[model samples]
Target: MRLCGGHSGLLLLLLLLLTSEFPPGWSELFGWRDKKVLNVECETTGYEIVGDDFLVLCPGHCVGQQPLVWGSGVYASISSVCGAAIHSGVLSDSNGGMVRVSKKAGMRGYVSKFANGLRSISLPKWSRSFVFPEASRSMAESSQQWEQESIVSTGDKVDGRRLSFEAYRKGFLSSEAKPAAKDVSSPKGPNPFQQYIGRNLGTASRKPMTTTVSPKKMNKDCNVDIAFLIEGSWSLGVRRFESQKRFVTKVVEELQKTTDGAAVGLIQFGHETKTEISLNKFPTLQGVTLAMRKVSPIGGTSNAGRAIDEVAESFFQKSAGNRREAPNAAVLLLDGWPNDDLEVPARVARETGINIFIVMVEGATSEELASGVHGDFVNKSVCRPNGHFSLHTDRWTASSALVSPLVSRICNTERLICSKTCLNSADIVFVVDGSSSVGLENFPALLEFVANVTGHFEIARAGTHIGIVQYTYEQRTEVELGRHTTPEGVREAVRRVHYWSGGTSTGAAITYTRREMFAHSRSGKRRLLVLITDGRSYDDVREPAAAARKEGIILYAVGIAWAIKDELDAVANDPKSEHVFFVSDFNDLKTVGPKLVENICKEYNALPRN
Candidate 1:
């Protein structure tokens, strides 16, 4: 029964190929008989949105937010790769305006580029979940390569279509992306992924099934936990390199001695994908030091989304004891710009309650860094008493020395400056009427009005809170003021909002406050509700208004354009009392908001109950 040498060799080769190439369903799932059907259509005209399939592109999307989207199978396979199902769709309530899903909030996924009609997504097995811009962004090339490595041909069935993966590289061009051939233009540049691509041949194509976890949460104290997602795109260089390493080392050393719950890790990055470190879950100084020591500055664009997935996995996985206790902080030392985006990371940080303090040691201000950050979080420097104006990172200095101090100043020894400040039971919420009469045309002008209005109070006081409740026919919570009292939270709450349609429901919201909301206030602290409307309430705002005011609530109302100034005047506790305001336009509301806040400050219960 002894087999020949060549036969034995052949058998071993087959076994190796079967195990390495296909993990589970290698024999039955895929085969070389599979073929690829490439249907690609390019058009100069942008597609119009008819309904669910064809959605009209919003003007705002092109200007700001996740304006980058293309029809591709990229995101579809992401959930499979991570071994978790992630839903991807825009917000339902969103209109022709910007639509961003809370699910894909942080940066994660492969580096496949997609535009109006051009997109390449390759969710390959090598694409493990991790954090940092470099690892995820590199996926563009890796995915392209994986696409090339795949050999698939489908029987094209409506329900059960079998796909195969023989091998991907198809000389220069075969099928899949008709133009997916790696641009072999240069050996050096930003597109490092291209360099590794070589051609082979075509076969069949199969959609993927996977999940992407955040590097942060995965890298928890289980082993090497703390990680710094350093940006390594071509946009970056030696500029922040030196500072990145120094701060990283400093943080690592500090983390070592402390019996902190997590281990410190490091991951250098660039482009939109790549995780220098996955949620390795390594515990102890050896693992932490090893991870920190392995960071090698290299290629890719800044995609913060992956970092979020990393943290999401790493943060929430901690034991219940740790979860029950007050949390500790995880610091990220980022230098350079995030050329691409993965906002989900920021959301993960918030949802998982991770105290993610980003220290960007670069010349860019907070605004510039914000353009690159995961959740578009603002700087904590600009805070006001009534919670109107918060600072943007653009407002902060970039020098390491200056930036570190600012980071320290913003993040109190316990938690976020904004979150803690409001914890003192003093975040304020203001409901405004931005109907036709009190509206601003452009977003900038509107933001300015909001800024000026929030600017009056001395925010430095025991953390005065600020939140916005905008009403048309309906009401929208622009800023959830109580989440955090720091200037940063204030800005994020207001960043992506606008004054839109709807009638005034002054009374309903007032009732909601009395019944559902304000009652959930953290402690026995004074709450203020300021109302500014240009006209009379569409509903019976009187009874609720009277009820609230009678319950020792600080209720104030203002009248503007065609509004029943007399009725509003009565809504205020006192007509000429500093509690009342009147405005002609949206900008004017800002003026009145500050004045009211200044008046409230004068009623200082904050200083010395002594």
Candidate 2:
């Protein structure tokens, strides 16, 4: 036992090493070796802290694989460094500690460290990298002076990334910590990421995209009966409301100068709708502009559906200033989505010959805009499909910039041609009951309904062929199958149909339609017979209706006041709800016009496209 002081000290150290279990730094050494076994082939990778999170680009591996231990093995072991401080209370006491997910980087990992905490990550000398206009070397130099921290992981896939705490706080990821004008050049102004964000996400891109209408095509003389349906809710503050009014005035002033002169009307809508100017009220551009200036915003909830109904019922009438031959249009200025169901009313407006141009400002969704326009209208005609004739702006001030495109689309009559292309392929015949109950006064309403429905289809010899037959005690052929080649011609023939006031003969009309109206030559097309009667049939309808169905004719029945519902149910195709319509009176026909047209279009659209 007798030994020198240095030997004794060495002996004591050896005993301490042998006796201690789970010693400090030893566990870390073993953990580091274990991690190295699990880690990938230590290839140099790049990472960038986008917002509050870090996007680590793993080359050969995909998401869900183990994260690379980003450091040289020489510095504080991986466990004591990044993994240990996390489990211990040391890093948790930091003031700026808050967990956030990457908003734009589109990764699943959360930021695992803060400020000085990043020092322990042991970023290799070669690990610095970035994306976009900056060169890798320059980015590394700029980032080296600044301490950066964050982490990324992989999880269940979704709309790429969600819950961007940093993007929400700082607006968007900065192109450079300090962007020099000479360093970055992109088609989307200074930031190329602006276009990237808009294309992927439905948010404001770094630089707003502005679209303009071709001026050469804009100045041509054209006649349009246009009504401006504006949002006047409090959310669209007074300044924004005034901006909307100015946009409308500018459009009207330009349109009125054309040789044919467009008739402009105004409707300021919120919880309540006010007719600021009727279409017939102001014939000149000066009168319309002055009227628009005096119109004030009435604060209330956004109810666009009601405004559309008002425009369809009251705004686009002859008494209100609508010309029979002029193309009718309604410019809807929306700041937000409607508070009610917009589909049905929008359908009615379009079926009534009004071309809806939806101008969506900030706060409107792509879904709402798509539902507000006619489903069959082409993209170019409405400026864009899904959100047709729609111009989306980042802020209220940007709405002024949309006037040219809106005017060009609304004024240029050529685009309005597609509004008539509703049905793709069909042989449609109108079987009308010209009974005495549908007197001279109501006969015009009947013809108007027929004209409205006829206008919705593509009336070409090869597209959707149209014919009409008026029935009383006897059936009279008003329009022959494939007789008219254009929608205009078909509508004219419908208008010319004379009222033959007599007794109801629904069965005879159905039999005549099946035997004569649906010719063998037109058998290739979908046969559709729309029967309109106002009273009980004087003759039996069951046998003829069965015969019509047997011949492959799809029957749709519309009955006005005093007409039998049982007869309508019997005459219509198998599903009565899908094929039959009933109105209280002649004036109520417009109510069901859009629904009938919608069903017809739905049937046609569902057909297999060749």
Candidate 3:
């Protein structure tokens, strides 16, 4: 009853063909059809690694079903994880082996690229990825050879005949392998696939990926003063109006749960704008939600421009519970085009250090959204060119989906505040009067004030640069512009400034800063000088202040106890109220610090970008 040897071999081959677990091309070429298949071992380091069969290399809570892999120096979605490893030079296609993928910080900017036979689609910024361990020399050589041979011209078949392992081994043993010829006449650089290969092979330097601040981290770090501007006009029926209220309530709830320092207020705009909730009215989540539920729609014409103006003039005032230290943001939810012009009011709102985010509901056009933005729609003034601040939905029913993304945008303080003003692109010099009048007890307070103001800026050579000048008869440059390129470095340098008390020569300090500290100021960057004094200067400051202003330097005068008002007026720039600040005591400097920063941002925003 036993079958012949040939028949038995044929039966075994058929079984292997039907029960193969390896990918299509691999089983046929490598005779691995009957080999024992092993489940991928996903090792965990504190964070849980999800996906039982396919491992997700990225860190953080893996929210969705898709598995992310590190390919071509970026986080990409590939059809096959093992194939991507081979294409990324982490494994060899000839004989695939175990790969060790470690998680790292999320990065900004991902691009689509091709490698070997695999195609990778880019993931969004702040999306997590993994770090693949270096492959063995033999494996690397095989992967490199396979990559060079697999790349084909546009329109060519990618799944051509697979090369034998012996042939690949022989090619690896050779000194070098030539790649497929590309058309020399083409103007475009090598295809994305080639570039991807070059980056992995070390032929080209890898571009440093910018680390993105996670949403959770951003929520804790950013303090936002947000006002919700709702359009409750006749065009938006009661149902849609209710939907808008629900959306806003949900957003506030999310913010309350996640954000560290957040204040919420609402204004309903129709024929007239009504303040439903002041920024300081409800300090807790329960109160805000209760107030939101009680809001009744005001049926009339939509005067969006007036509502925006109200936000700029009244909603964000200190009386309204607007924190001077927090960045100002306004979320405008509109159902249709406004009857009044939006350009002038929006411009004024932006000029007042308010970042405007517009969400156009059904019946509103993208053109109106563009018009309502702070700058030209193409080049946004506040946020990045990526349209995170503006949103439009074709139907009101879909409004629920906008809450998470909107909350994320509001919490992203780096993009929300720093990108809007001169916080990221100016040179700020602090001139302190370290005289005998300012006793040793007050010196630390003065330094603390300087550090607090410095915290508002992103210290970088290409971004905002900070300088310090401590004057007591003679001026000393404690920190020079561009001396420190990081916030920590600048803060540390400020802490190290030694206090030396002598005579007060405010005029000489201003002149010294202008001559020594600002001599090397970069062109196309805003120049700002902040002068802090406790009393009147022994020497004249009017001429030096005037000279500083003449050279296009913006001056701010901060006077502590016993300081002369006349001197502050003479030292400050035009519109003295905006540029001059007075505090009764040295400890009150903390209260004035934010106001000074807000004013500086306003002045910086008013200047035309170079």
- Candidate 2 has its poorest 10 consecutive residues by lDDT at 192-201
lDDT of 2 by residue, 458-502 (tens): 555445788899999899999998899677788788878898998
Candidate 3 vs. truth: CA RMSD?
23.0
Clashes of 2: 2
| Residue pairs with backbone overlap in model 2 | 109-153, 382-389
Ranked by TM-score, the better of candidates 1 and 2 is 2
Residue runs of model 3 more than 4 Å from their true location after superposition = 1-219, 364-386, 417-496, 499-610
lDDT of residue 544 for candidate 3: 97
Worst 10 residues of 3 by lDDT: 195-204
Against the true structure, candidate 2 has what lDDT? 0.56
TM-score winner between candidates 2 and 3: 3
Per-residue lDDT for 291-398 in model 3, tens only?
888888798878877787677555765445665345678898877677665655565456445777888777645775555543343224233335877887888789
Best to worst by lDDT, what's the order?
3, 2, 1
The residue-level lDDT of candidate 1 at 319 comes to 24
